[model samples]
Target: MHYVKSKSILSAKNGMNLYRGCTHGCIYCDSRSKIYNMNHEFEDVEVKENALELLKKELIKRPKAMIGTGAMTDPYIPAEKHLKFVRNSLELIYRYGFGFTCITKSDLVLRDLDLLEKINEKSKVVVQMTLTTADDELCSILEPNVCPTSRRFEVLKMLDEAGIATVVWLCPILPYINDTEENINSILDYCIEANVHGVLCFGMGLTLRDGNREYFYEKLDEHFPGLKARYIKEFGNDYSIPSHDEKRLMEIFKYRTSKAGILNDTNEIMSYLSEFPQKSVQSKLF
Candidate 1:
């Protein structure tokens, strides 16, 4: 890991990525796409040395809104155990009375439950997690470096018990791999059991682009041998590689999430993530 001074931490939309690059070795990572233009190896995480400082400055100057992280890199990556940037950023967010939201697959998020609860008590805190495959063994193969879906389910339950809201990103279901109706229903069951507020699923397939496509194909050859050739034959450099069962699987996804009363629409989930709690506004008024 290397540290670099960052000029600003929050994006125009109030999103923050305290670290760049990732060690999570997920084969379908879109961040690896050349369109992002990272200068270093994906695993050589780039730490924004001044992220917390910049966050404090930005929070002070900007109007209160939900401050999000983990879009570009999971803020709770293993590096967080020592660096503690994500934890410190939460402290700052709580101190300044801003709502907080983050997308992560790590169970390490439970470590900061105190801060999340505090923030939710004052404003809002939404914990969004990604669950692609329900089977532990398959989960290990797909998201090798992170906690399995089972543990993430526990994290969601924990967040619910703490009175913090939660969302799930049920996505990037590899076409011939984890795109089965059983996998989708299993993950939705976990969401239902955990009482997640929403499940964000764009579709039942993954996207492949230049940099990520090469990496994904390499891993496919290593793990699922001969699958790479099939992908080439079938997809042939297409960006959106929808599953053969995408239509049927999406029906199951929508039906399950709708029955559970979980927000399944992407727009609704994004709006929920961005909305600041009215309680925070009232507190400011008083």
Candidate 2:
């Protein structure tokens, strides 16, 4: 891990990543793709030393606060164990009494549960977790070296039981990998049982680009020989890689989430996520 000054902290949409690379080593990470132009090794991890200071300034000056992170890289990577950068940012967010949201697969986030609960209590905080496959063995192969699917499910359950509203990213279900109806149904079943607030599904598939496409294809060759060739022939530089059974799977996804009252539309999910602040607290008080 190395520290460098950042020009800016938050994006126009109010998102910020304190780190630039991930250590989770997920074989299919799109952040590793060349389109991102990350100059360092995918695992080298560039730390934004001044990000906290910048964020503090932004938070103080902004008219409203709804900070999000973990888009380009996972905030709670192994490097986070020592850097504490994310923790520092969280402290700042809470100090300012700002709403917070994070997308991560690491159970390390549980370490910040106390702070998260406090943020949720004082303002708003949402934790988003991605669940691709319910099968543990398959999970290890696709998202190897991170917490298993069961552990992630437990995280969702724990968060829900704590009254911490949660959203599940039921996405990137790789074709010929985990796109089966059974896999999708099992994950959706768990999401429903966990009583999550919403589930985001983008038509039951993954995206591949210059860097990410090559990496994903290589992994495909390593794990499922001939599958990479299939993808190459079907998707030729195209970004969207929908499953062959996408229509049926999407139907199930929509039906199951709708029945559970979980938000499923991408626009609706983003609208809900990007919502600046909820008036529920003030309304409840009134």
Candidate 3:
């Protein structure tokens, strides 16, 4: 890991990535795509040394809104166990009376449950987790460096019991690998049991671009020999490789989420994540 001074923190939308690159080793990571243009290795992990200071300053100046992270890199990556950047950022968000949300694949997020709960009470906090495959073995193969789906389910349950809202990103389902009725159903069952507020699924297939495409094909060759050749034959260099089963899989997704009363519309979920709580507004007014 290396630290670099950051000129600023929050995005125009109040999102910030305190770290760059990742060590999660997820084979389908889009962050590795060349379009992002990272000068360092994907595993090197560039730390924004002044992120917390900048965040505190920005929080004081900007009108209250939800502060988000973990978009480009998982904030709870293994490095977080020692660095505590995410945890410190959470403290600032809570202290400054801003809502918070993040997308992560690590159970390490549970370490900051106390602060998350506090933020929830004061404003709002939504914990969004990505669950692509329900099978633990496949999860290991797809997201090797992160916690398994079973453990993530437990984390979701814990968050539910703590009165924190949760959301799941069930996506990037690799075709001919995990794109199956059984796999989708199993993950949906977990979302139902966890009482997640929503499930965001763009489609049943994953996107492969320049940098990530080569890396994904290499991993496919290593683990599922001959798969890369099949991908090239089938997909060529297309960006969006929709699953042959996309229509059927999306039907299932809509059916399950609708029946469970969870928000399935992408626009609706994004709105929920950005909306600050009415209670927070009233408290501030008084």
Q: Write the per-residue lDDT of candidate 1 for residues 69-120, one digit (tens) a residue.
A: 9898988999999999999999999999999999998999999999999999
Question: Clashing pairs in model 3?
Answer: none
The lDDT ranking, best first, is 3, 1, 2
The TM-scores of all predictions, comma-separated, are 0.97, 0.95, 0.97
In model 2, what lDDT does residue 225 have?
95
Name the top lDDT candidate.
3
Q: Rank order by TM-score, top first?
A: 3, 1, 2
Off by over 4 Å in 1: 280-286
lDDT tens digits, residues 1-286, model 3?
8999999999999998999999999999999999999999999999998998999999999998999998999999999999888999999999999999999999999999999999999999999999999999988998999999999999999999999999999988999999999999999999999999999999999999999999999899988999889899999999999899999999999999999999999999999999987762344554
For model 3, the stretches where C-alpha displacement exceeds 4 angstroms are 280-286
RMSD of each: 2.0, 2.4, 1.9
Using lDDT as the yardstick, the better of models 1 and 2 is 1
41 Cα displacement, candidate 3 (Å): 0.3
Count clashing residue pairs in model 2: 2
